[model samples]
Target chain A: MSTIARSPRRAAFFLSDRTGITVEMLGHSLLSQFENVPFDETTLPYLDTEEKAAAVVRKINERASADGLRPLVFSTFVNPQIRFVLDSANALHLDCFSIFIASMEAELGIRSSHAIGLSHRVGQPLDHGRRIEAIQFTLEHDDGLSQRNWQQADITLTGISRTGKTPTCLYLALQYGIYAANYPLIPEDFNRVELPAQFKKLRGKLFGFTIDPMRLHRIRSERKPDSEYASLKNCQYEVRQAETLMRREGIPYLDVTSKSIEELATAVLHQAKLERKIY
Target chain B: MSTIARSPRRAAFFLSDRTGITVEMLGHSLLSQFENVPFDETTLPYLDTEEKAAAVVRKINERASADGLRPLVFSTFVNPQIRFVLDSANALHLDCFSIFIASMEAELGIRSSHAIGLSHRVGQPLDHGRRIEAIQFTLEHDDGLSQRNWQQADITLTGISRTGKTPTCLYLALQYGIYAANYPLIPEDFNRVELPAQFKKLRGKLFGFTIDPMRLHRIRSERKPDSEYASLKNCQYEVRQAETLMRREGIPYLDVTSKSIEELATAVLHQAKLERKIY
Candidate 1:
């Protein structure tokens, strides 16, 4: 055990001119490295204008005074004036955007855009349309509702209820613009050796998801408590049968019981060789 | 206008043992620095096994031989053996995990668990329940479908059609486990200088989404072409009225026209102070 883990807690802020996702990720990566200090994070996003910047400054100053400790601020402000204001606030700060953008501008021999949405990367505008399209597509086709479009889908996920198919598919769509649709796997399907008949034609785009039987029982029980379907034996049997079917059918699958949706979706995309619709 | 704009396209692979999102983000950040090059991206996620590693190697070599251009590989493999195997592949590689993990281990006197699901950042497994809960909540409460649970939401979004309310709310839920619900701003509501009736009681939890009228028109027009609702003038009128309504009601809002769903979600959480369900 480290003393740092026992150290006093601190307030951490992730500030940005836009959504601040990039800066948050960057800051989280750094902070995750230091496990001793627990963080209570406040994300202040969309500081695109002077007024928003001033408001953020006021909050920082207020926190410092009230808490009697300097807050740790991680910002991705592309505008110099706003970044200056944030930096001047009574807090320890790390700016993720300016350093990277400035270095890139110098190396590339061009002035950076300094726009509000630069954190998403540059130059291509079609990504927005594609991402939005993918989201709409995924939502419409979610949970095997609209299998009519699976032929057009970049990938289709199949797993038992509560195996994390919906969130994983949504992550794939929202983050990468991949058209991902999911179908439920019934315990009854364990009767047949093959995958569900609905997904048979789309086998090329199909992927499998599995979870630990204990975790699956817990998750399913939440939806339907004390039911046979939620029983531990059933959960174990379903998972085993599903895995056997997947292996027998040569389908790549992930055990998502321990993984976040981000991990599940990313793994599926890579293992399945699905091209991101946005990029 | 630079000659680099004519640069030949190259293959880019985001390879990882877990979700490739971190490496992909790092890669997109780096590739976005240059405006001239085009890329075909393949995400090789969830390469946890030696068999998967071997498969990835074969693909890389195949591409290299076919294209006569070694692909740019961005990897976050923490296992020394997998990292070695990937590095040995004939590709220009950038490792995001090892370098940072090495430095951190030396500083903390702790070796990383090198776990496959660790990119979501260590410990306290309860995040799984919270994330699942948030996703379920968002799905049920989506688009003001069931406002009976409005009081329970961390934040509710209001905006005209296609201003990015749904995807942004979904992002908040999936990524940060924030219970985000969204309501659409109907054209009829523009006549009244008030917020929607559904989310009136939960005003503090309400945030508005605004978009450029031209962009709004483009988006709406796609859903319903040449319709009175999707007209440029209607988009302009609805946006102006909505902003006025939000301002009058003393609600904070974000202009999402130029922002990605990731950015929109992050900004809303910060601006609205929605406590991240995960952190």
Candidate 2:
């Protein structure tokens, strides 16, 4: 067997004028491609001022000196002055905005606003209000807590326990302003071939999640040790019965054994043909 | 006043081999800068195959032909063949990956893996497990449900109702693998000047949220209309008392009147100096 060599650790920074979530995510995407070089990542958010940019520059330069290599800096500052300040650092600065904004402006024949934090601003008060409303609605409808407004839900996810129904619903509500509700499918429902009575009229809005029995058993076992609910045979029976019921009812379902919450949410949106109310 | 002219609406597409969240967000950032140009945005994710890329090309071309203007296409496909298929569309293509990957590869003197869905994959099983655990812990600890593992929390948020404590805590747990717990400050807690006994020993882990009295009144009114709990007087009293308590107890706080959940979570992380356990 060949032994793997240890790679050098490099420092990477994700800097942005706002929350920096977008910048950090995009930077992580790029850095993940270079699997051999492990990155020590740090995110510096709300760097709208030149003073803050200068401070970040010192940090980057110090990291470069310590590593004996130039650090990689990914930034999304809209203000040119702040971008210039960050560019002064002794690192490979990847300006996420400047690289494309110039071309976009040329194509559109209009100047950019150069406003900081515009991406995450509460645009269209109605949309912002809807997002909050969706979150509240989602929380109220979690785990089939309240069917008071079941008809108002944009999508309803049904699954056995620990199939990632709650987190996926929350992500849909948080990110896209979708009024997502989740219902758990217990043994009682699994015993019947028909869809649950509450979901009969909402068939089109319903989606389902299934997981590998082995994975489900492991997940449940963690939550409750040595309980029949977490038994392997019980998990297998639940999953098989749930999938069979979903198929019999013609409900489209996804396997959540390996999907992330973001992936599950996006898949639900795509499969359910739901429009994103908020960006 | 000068007459405000209606701007032309342009079609913009965000294409990605995976969830398309990063591309959509970054594209939105750029599009938001061009305020005069209204963009009708659509995201086509999971375009890992050339057939899907060709289908997207047809749609983009159809949109361009109907609108009599080229649409803007922002993509992050890692495969060259799929990118080439998409480039055949009659649109203003803005390739997110190609723009920076070349420079990154050159800087590091290494070739990228060009792997699709690597950005959101469950890297390091331990990290992914920690994220799930954090989400479960946050959900269980919501609204001060349990103080059994209060010391294990990365951060605990305290605020009066309608101050956006729950959503912010969920965001922290969802995005950063942070074990965030939130406690609602009731009138009883407000009556006491000292910190709550549950939080007395966890001062450093505690962060507070305060909102404008008017805003809090409006938010609470929606839930409990015309009640003393939702009155402006009660809201003002709660705000005054909560802020006074936070100041007296030296607990750092933020005003969530205008901040988004993403912004609030990031601010908490920054102020608390909490390390992000997941990207």
Give me the candidate number with maximum DockQ: 2
Off by over 4 Å in 1: A1-7, A10-18, A40-128, A187-198, A240-251, B1-17, B39-127, B187-198, B233-248
Native A-B interface contacts kept, per candidate: 0.17, 0.53
Model 1 chain A weakest 10-residue run by lDDT: A118-127
For each candidate, what's the DockQ?
Answer: 0.26, 0.52
Candidate 2: tens digits of C-alpha lDDT, residues B1-279 = 756544448999999998899999999999998877889999999998999999899999998887878999999888989999998999999998988999999989999999887775644322347777888889889999998888889999999987888888888988888999988888898777676677898889999999989988888888799999999999999999999989988999988887877888899999999998876
- Write model 1 residue lDDT over B1-279, tens digit each, in one string: 774443446788888776666667656765664556566777767788878898898899898777777877777776778988888788776676664565545534566666555436642332467787888899888877896767888888887787878888888888888888887878677676565566678878888988889988887888899999999998899999888888888878878766666666766776666677663
In candidate 1, which residue pairs get closer than 3 Å at backbone N, Cα or C atoms, i.e. clash? A4-A36, A5-A36, A19-B263, A270-B45
Question: Which candidate's lDDT is highest?
Answer: 2
Clashes of 1: 4
lDDT of each: 0.75, 0.87
Q: Which residue pairs show backbone clashes in model 2?
A: none
